[model samples]
Target: MKDDDTRIKFDSEEELIDYYCSKPHPKAFTPSIVIVMLLCSLVGGIIGMELIVKFGLSTNSSIIGALIAVIVGMLPMKFARKFRNIHTQNLVETAISCATFGAGNVLMVCVSIIWVFNKPEMCTGILIGGVIAFVVDITMMYWLFDTPLMGADEAWPIGIATAETILAAAEMGKKAKLLIGGIAGGIIGTWLGLPMDIIGVCGLGNIFALTAFCIGLIMNGYWPTWFGYSLGDYYVPQGVMVGAGMVGLIQAIILIVRKYKGRSKTETPKEELKTADSTFIEPEESELTVEQENELLGEKDEKTGHIYTRTTKQMTQTFVRGIILYIIGAVIMALIGGIAAEMSEGMLVVWVIYAMAAALISEILVGISAMHSGYFPAMATVIIFLVFGIFIGFPPHALAFLAGYTACTGPAFADMGYDLKAGWILRGRGRHVKFELEGRRQQYYAELFGAAVAVVLVFIFYRSYFLAGRIPPVASVYKATIDAGVNGTVLRQILLFAIVGAVLQLISGLKRQIGILFAAGLLITNPIAGVAGLIFLTFRYFIEKKFGDEGRKNLNVVSAGLIAGAALFSFCTNTFKLVSTNSKKG
Candidate 1:
């Protein structure tokens, strides 16, 4: 093998950076990753549905699924000598969104329709509502985030932090290696069909959601295509899991026999650690100080030394197009409702006007909120929807459409704004989020694919979960709120706050004032992240006190490991539970 250790090696860090950053990897956001993402999403949807039905919990599903997806999606990069950091981020983004949408949106919403309103018959209405929400949200994202807010580099603190984390992990430091170990553990668990019940014994719930899915399979006494693209569907031999129990049993016995015959072996700890250190991956340094590179493509204001991302005319054009789309979408919803959903034109007009107002105003607030807090103000959005619904008299289909539209759109805008800002942070471009327009176009393409797939998955899951009789209490409550009788007083109060908030935001733009107050207030509202931040800071402080500045620096590397560890724990536990349940059933 020509002495593998001496075959090739970089002499210095600068040479290493040049080698990796010279060209991008080809594995990002391709069909291969897309398939992996879809499979994860299917599993996530099933797990989320399982939790909701069994324990009325779904909040942690998105985060857990996203983390796992990140690990699996990045596994290929472990072997790629030319892998780029941002490409790994893209794979994570694509896979995580699928998992999130599958469980968080589709199954949960379906459960709400059936359980909350006792209206499983309103399936069509649900789809309509989701479509309208998606459309409005996409429009709001384009108008509020990518254009005017591109100049607002610090708009999303969380995105910036996340991008930094990804880059830090890419350096293949101790933290990155730990994260990789966690990912390996997770893959092992999945392959072995492990169960996650151990965590549940300690009241740590939702760790074993998909783990028991095989039990669901066993009870079916059959497998159907309607179950979606399950892992076993294509991966299992004999074309199905129907009789795989016997095969597993035989393999288990063989493994037992092998274990008895084979002696245990272990590598020397010192040598393994030495090898690990020698193989550590390092990332290119693309981040630049302002003085290093100032020829960025964004325009600068000559008089004030300020950067203007886009012209006022461009922003104006974006707003006009968004408004036009909003109006047309509403008209289409109304027309569709008239034909099949029993929505009157007058009611539709009322809902559309209210949706337009709510979407426009809340888009700004949500975008601003995202910039300052590292979160989208989802609660505020629901309140906005409810308040607007009260003003519109809560007409059936119109109420559904408006509620879904406003509640969903603002948060979408917030995510887009944050992600764009994150991209800028990672790519280190002052004027643009990406150097290549193709990357931007790819984002749009991936977004459309994800969105379209989400709607379809939602539709499929709506049927599946509804048939399974899983009703979402929160979703039902929200749905009932939409279907409830209106109170005029509530409308007055909402309007009062809305008008005041709008005026404040508008005035702040001219004076550049609200960013500070809004940022401060936003941080205050996020007690969980705030407390979490304090804990991390305290931990870091103690490390510095004990070991000086070097320990503080190492914390950056360790953070990624912790994230991957958490994800690995979840994956192993979940898979363990599945294997246990499946074995028992078999």
Candidate 2:
């Protein structure tokens, strides 16, 4: 086995354990690390807000964050040495990532909905509600991650891309050159108006899912020309998401229930030993001494086939708690946003229930799509719920609150999953249970701190942007939809396609994620990207078939470089454009 700078090539499980036990991992949240995290958070938060408000998009900034940590580690100062630890870099990446979504996705989007609705007075209330929803969003994913429903084994292509970037930078060999070359290619490709990120994801994600997604994208682009009508004319994408999302949620519940039932039937008696004294079974290939091997032998967890730091039951409870919190937040938003004044008693009750359900359901749909293909249609998902709200006769003011609250959920949830997946890889893929859990907890804390910073920044600066009439452009779409109102014809069209969506999801099952990815692609109009994804998927299949896992792994590394380079280029160019525009205004 070849050893990398970031990880050791342990000879055996016993050796891996002994090595980790002897050398305590570096602390993730040292004072020095926090200072770096704060800087990255500020930069990422500002860039994310500017990009979203100016261009209607936000990039994953974790690659940029990891790059900053690497630069800091290279500084000659002794104090900067702490940044060299891969775990510390992971935390830094988490901070910037959390802040980016916290500001652009949650805080700005929420406040913009109210401002765009001409209800600027209610921005404060909506902002508070958004913060609460944001917290619940991250907490829900933190607990539910690694479960069968949102398993760590899923593609999570963005996370994998970020991890590979970090590893390449740290190791700095042939892989690093591949990454650099890929990054250059990505920048050049993107400059030519090609979708480099999609191509990159095609090399790393599920082939079947991406194929479906690319087909949907192609259909979306050419639907009017090919079929003599626009899909959005009848809300086809929204209808598909509605049907697929419901089925997807049901599938998740079924998975959890099945796992619980199977585990219940084969329950095991607890050993009379504590966690510290607990033993583990050794693999046959372990090259440990006879005494060491004997000492490590023990029974595995009969419930789960392997050791996990967190349990399934705990994740389920955490999800329930998150839903309850979202319900309470919805109530608060209704009372504070003056929604209570607009609706009757029965209607108010219905509104609250609908709001909470919309937020959670959108998160599930977005998460599934992102995990499968690194593409989440967050705004489109919210609009689906918005259509439903209009169908239920929600007044414009009430719909504003609904859109604002629900809009904050899905992006934050998906972003958190990406960051966590990156950390999971850096933490030895959960092989060291205690270490992985502790590292994850530290990452969570870093995210909270970053979110806190974003909230403060938005509170201070959001009004300036609104005054300049630079609110997120999506807010206008929501405002327009609320004004247009839903008609009987549109509602009928939605209902008709929903069944088709549900059937597709059911047939695909949870593993393929075809239905959700198809909906994701349909929600965004970009034919060139779809074409790029198809081409790369074909190329990736040929490489894997000819060269095997090693070739596949190398291809994934180059793909990561492509994604990172494209994202970095986008951020820099956008930031420059924003600054230049702001300076002229000043």
Candidate 3:
């Protein structure tokens, strides 16, 4: 950790304080970074739309954005020197990462639902609603980050990969060569149609959870051939996800409650806990300053003197605020989509309330899976909520609105976690509290800008894609599920599977999240990915066994390299395809 390039070193306490207090941090929203961010956003948007439409998945573009920043910094120009700052590079990566998810997972999915249902007239309402949901989702993540729940220490594999990629590129040593080699291998493997990203995750993610995920994938992919029953056809995956998601949410609440409830005993004095400022209450005779009080209230890293900025209380309030905001956004979408006109007042109320709840739950489920394994089942989670909406007997148009609005929440939420995790690492793991917070705020602004860009890109280009009959694979599934509706047999299957999923999640507890990862795998039904990931995991285990912690550290760099390489290849090839296809159409 001491040799890690992401850390800041100073000669003495005076130097450290001067570095934190006096240095002018790189501005995220400056004109130069903004220009680079916009360019990266365009590239990210194109890659996202192409990959999602063609293959039904979107890779994190953080590495691509960071690589672009690094490339720009290497140019021989006076102005280019400023781009060398790691903070500036982090902001650029944050922007493109948001744009990628915002375009593909949020806006495009929403628009496609309306188009698939031949309700193009409602596309405007869905887009606006999606945009609003996206903003609120990112805002909530911003507030929730660094809390006890989704702390900076969470795996957040994609973020770690991006951060390592930047660090390696800047340092340019043996680690850099390893990263470059891994990237090249990733590119070559992906070109051969391999799941390089899954392999990358296999090396970095929780082994137990990923093993469960691989088992689920194998079961989902093979059971149809061996037993002649499609898990998806029986709604088995959906049921499992529903059960696991419910338990996962409860587990989160329990953790939050237990943390706060036991705070008086473990954290603060009983008298301090009762004060207006809660844990910040200091002794009268001590006369400690506010900084000292804050340090007392938060967790301090002994080596770096870094105290966490977000409190448990603040996280809870932000979560509640997010719920309220989602409710408002749902109501706005329902009104704008004209769903209110077709439903009874009671049913309309139910629809709005359910949409809000569904969005929040979906985001949590997706966020947890992403934090653990970097695999977010956004579409499947949306479908799970859509199934519930069907049971509630909403009309087809309302279902479309509900599904689209629900889809908008999770991807951006999870992607925001990745960006912040990267920023947290680059900012020296929050060692300098004020500087870290400032960098985080800048990342948020950059995310907002990128999301706004994605909204515009989707708004402008979705019609062309729809006209060309290029819709996401999930859109058709959404329509089919809505049209077929649900039956008693389906309900029974879902309930049975739900129980199994719940038990698995409960047994796994929160940290491992085996159940969530298993559900994510089952939802996809890609046996090849499972097999490939298992192979990579085996390799990683051996490497660690032979070399110990050093091997693990080296593997982290290589895994990051693999992800970056695959992403770069995907971007270049996909961008070319998009351009050529659109040109031919024109």
Q: How does residue 542 of candidate 1 score in lDDT?
A: 71
Q: Each prediction's Cα lDDT score?
A: 0.43, 0.81, 0.82
Q: Which tens-of-lDDT digit does each residue in 158-273 have in candidate 2?
A: 89888877777666667778899989988998888889999998988889999989988998998999889999988898888788888888897896687578764433323422
Best by TM-score: 2
Query: Quick one: ranking by TM-score, best first?
Result: 2, 3, 1
481-531 per-residue lDDT for model 1 (tens digits): 666654655444434433433443344441232322232233122232333
Clash list (residue pairs), candidate 2: none
Q: Please give, for residues 1-586, the per-residue lDDT of candidate 3 as tens digits.
A: 0222233444532333334334567787788888999999988887788778877777678888898898888787777776767778888999999999899878888879888988888888888888888999999889888776677777788898898887776656677788889999999999999988888888887888988888888889998899998988888898999898889889988977986887654354324434533323233436555643553365432333334467667778988998899999988888887878989999999998898998888888888888878888898998888888888899999999898988998899899999999888776675555566677889999999899889889989999989888898889989998998988898889989999899999999887888888999998868988999888889999999999998998898888877777778877787777789769979
Q: Which stretches of model 1 miss by more than 4 angstroms?
A: 1-21, 24-31, 44-89, 106-121, 135-146, 150-152, 155-158, 174-297, 301-312, 337-344, 360-364, 416-422, 429-436, 480-586
- lDDT for model 3: 0.82
**What are the clash counts of all predictions, listed in order?**
12, 0, 0
User: TM-scores across all candidates?
Assistant: 0.60, 0.90, 0.89
Judging by TM-score, tell me the better candidate of 2 and 3. Answer: 2
| Clash total of candidate 1 | 12
